[model samples]
Target: MKPLVVLVGATASGKTGLSVELAQRLDGEVINGDSMQLYRGMDIGTAKITADETQGVPHHLFDILEVTEEASVVQYQALARQTIAAIRERGKTPILVGGSGLYLRAATDVIEFPPTDPGLRAQIEAELESEGTAVLREQLREADPESAAVIKDARRLVRALEVVRLTGRTFTSFLPQRNHLPSLEPVLQLGMKIERSLLHERIADRVHQMHSTGLLEEVRRLDAAGLRKGRTASAAIGYQQFLRVIDGVLTEEQAVEETIIATRKFARRQETWFRADARITWLDTACEQLIDQALEAVRG
Candidate 1:
């Protein structure tokens, strides 16, 4: 069993700052669990940490890939496991921190996801590219209405359909067996939470700051790299909105407003997802004794 500390929360909930503080106190290294933070040159829109902000603490999995390359959850899990093992072998704690629930869940679940069918996957992807998402979505809506509701994106929907078409089982039926790393050294999982109003305000401010700091320019660079707006990475909340703005589908001001709204919706989904997790130990952001309480948890 590995001794791990996980910090999970929604965007703009102050995960990075608190994780850094906790790592300094605990003598730990941070392994990023955020998806957007993995891509190189996608700094401002993703609110990626600067070298100055890290303040000499080593971080993993930031700026590792180009926007043209796709890093899947399976790949992330493998890298995270290797990183965690190295950290533990050196007798330091491994602090896993970020807002990506899927990535975090993939790392911690300790389950082998159903093996993907490469040929079928390629065919499905081709259909997605040629037929467009709406048409493929309609196809899924007919075959697997339940899955269609959840996998709304064309790429995801097509993949789900592929699994079902090949195996004759609902994509949900092939769920990997649920397993967890043995809990030792009291794996402290802290979730930062704040009021809706305050969180929304913070998200809006962060969006404005990204705009001021050249998020549009970053998106243009990704576009230049041949990654278009509708690609999986580009579908990310902030980046996609700006891509629309760049394409003349939206105004700059409209993009800002839509980005903020989309981010708020994502935060709500995150809150809902984590709320159901029995493992999480929630901490109110407004509590005056937050650090003390968190420290106490980690100590215990």
Candidate 2:
């Protein structure tokens, strides 16, 4: 059997296509590591892989939550590891795929996440809204510069601060070190690499395609499903922007542009987050020999 193969990269970096190809070669099933993909009815906005895309390889941990629920990394850690074990039991390889850095690591690494205090988290979140992400990020910088430098958004920034307050330890302490030790078994982590300009083009095109293919409609359906009630699902990149369109605060054109910008920024953050790990073998996303290269990495 093959070792666990993890394909990670920025959004629109072609990780999904590479994943299916790799799974075919490795006789593996794909596991969802993207946090947003776990929610039901979050398909279009998350760019969720369709049944046709899976190409007969089984996928796990997708559409497992309602839009009204929040995603917890701790809960995901348990679910993902269980799924990984089950796949190994069937003698098939497990291909962990997506751009969610922390979730990916939590599945594959020896991370001891600190317990959360909801009251503390709520207070921090309130401060985040009132004082803004800049201020919360500044605090995180003072407390833990490592996490602050890598974290780009308000949500993660708030979590970082919350962990600091709850544990009196730096949030980065929970992050995997450079060694990238796998908790369960050996892992072959592959990061898809692409030129920044090409990635930017891909992001813009994807955002436009999402709008054309009914991202607003998906958001509307989820909105009626209590998307706003869920803290995490409602804040997803495409969904977040389109909700403005749903509110009449922004036109579809403006939402598309904003989604493109936010996605590009999120992609950059993903690149930075994954690049910091030295254990990941980089694969040129555009190369015709990509699958062979990954196989070589697997065998070697």
Candidate 3:
């Protein structure tokens, strides 16, 4: 089997630009891994790559859903696998690119996710809405302490606990996905790296640029469509903070500052997520040699 070339990294780490170049070189089609980028009309906040940026190369799974729809790593895994298989059938490499570690990992790892209990799932969601995530975290800590320690967000923790609560099985039981095995296909995991200071600066600049491009208006459009800040649509970084500004809870300056800070924190969490995956080949964008090195690794 031919290898699937996966480009992973922290946010604003140059995955988009590099993947375009790699796809042009390798005759590959790019697949979206970033969760936020899947929503339509979320361009500015999500830092979605424009058609101009794609340089005529085909891109997949981006802007496929409306902001009101919920997307999960499980769904991404299924869709991405289908897309990759289709690309392979056409004799093209499937280049999975973005900073979303869970989506990327889920694509590669084949796990038998246990059956779900819809009623239990609904009950957990109701609990989450009524009791808040802290209570859910406590439940997760009690049921799946190992998973609880690793999961950072309340949303994720709650889901993990809900899985166990509904199925009476461990969350990890569905993971360490076998689908990602290298023996099944040639899999090359490339991680783009940047210096911390430089990454922070880039993040700030991007947030500023989003504002200049009318990120606030975009958020307003979504709000007018009946999307609320705490909803899944609001989970994307810039939109979340800017919604506060729109609601008059935060000043514009405060929103910008909060957006930058939140983005940096998210990047740190991304680093933590990818760091544990020993299969990744780290490429520093600051080094001109990185691309060639990655190309060589892929060709090997």
Candidate 4:
């Protein structure tokens, strides 16, 4: 089997451009692993690759969801695996690209997600609504410190607590192990490594560029299309800050500044998550001969 090629990195680390080049050279189809990029009309904030950027390569799993619909990792895993199999069967390399670590692992690794209980989930959600995320975060800290340490939002915290209550096991226990699943093909994981200071500067510039490119206009359009109704979409980095602008709580300048800060923090979290996986081959994205280096890594 042709090993699946995965390109992972923090936001603004230039994965899209390099992935397109690699796909062109390798005759590969790009499969998006970013969670937010799945939603349609989320182009600007998600930094989704444009048609021209794709360089005529076939891309899968992009713009697959409505803004109001929540994305599930379980569903994404099944879809991504199916896509990978079809691509391989067609004699095309499957290049998985994005910064979402869990989603990437879900697609390529032997991870089993826990079943959900609507009643229990509803109860936990109600508690979260009434008590706020702080209370549930503490509860999760006690039940599953590993999950709590990483999961920042109320929805995820509630889910983790629900899993703990329903299965009597820590949420982290259901995470992907170091070993690969026998049923799936092996993956060559490549991660983009950038200097922290340069990455921060890139993130700041990207945020400014997003604002300049009418990200607020995009947010306004999405909000009109029920963006706030979608839990996941509403909580996205740029969208949330812009939503605050819409709510009259923040000025546009404040929104822009806040978005930069939030993005920097998110990049840090992404780096921490991907760095924990020793299987990935880290490459310097800033190098002039990045494509050649990446190709050598794959071929070697």
* Model 3 spans with C-alpha error above 4 angstroms: 127-142, 147-158, 175-184
Model 2, range 142-261, lDDT digits (tens) per residue? 999999889988877888899998888998787667564655668889999999999999999988988889898899999999999998898899888889988889999999999888
- 3 against 4, candidate with superior lDDT: 4
Candidate that would win on TM-score: 4
Q: What is candidate 1's lDDT per residue for 1-300, written digit by digit as tens?
A: 445889998899988987788778878899999998998888888888899998788899898877877768888988987888898887778889988887887766655455678899889889888888888777777777777788855667877888777877777765543334444243668899789899999999999998888888888888888656326578778888988988999988899899999999999988887776778888888888777767777877
Q: Each model's number of backbone clashes?
A: 0, 0, 7, 0
Relative to the true structure, how large is the alpha-carbon lDDT of every model?
Answer: 0.81, 0.90, 0.84, 0.92
Q: For model 3, how big is the CA root-mean-square deviation?
A: 2.7
How well is each residue in 1-300 modelled by candidate 3, as lDDT tens digits? 668999998889999999998999899899999988888888889899999999999999998877777776778888999999999999988999988776777787755655556677778888988999888888888888888788887666766877897778778767663224543356888998789999999999999998988999999998887657335777778888898998899988889999999999999999988877788888879988777877988987
List clashing residue pairs in candidate 1: none
TM-score of 4: 0.92
**What is the TM-score of each predicted model, taking all chains together?**
0.89, 0.87, 0.89, 0.92
Tell how far residue 35 is off in model 3, in angstroms: 0.7
Candidate 2 residues lying further than 4 Å off, grouped into runs, are 119-172, 180-183
Give the top-scoring candidate (lDDT): 4
Quote the lDDT for 3 in model 4.
82
Score residue 299 of candidate 4 by CA lDDT: 93
RMSD, every candidate, angstroms: 2.9, 3.1, 2.7, 2.3
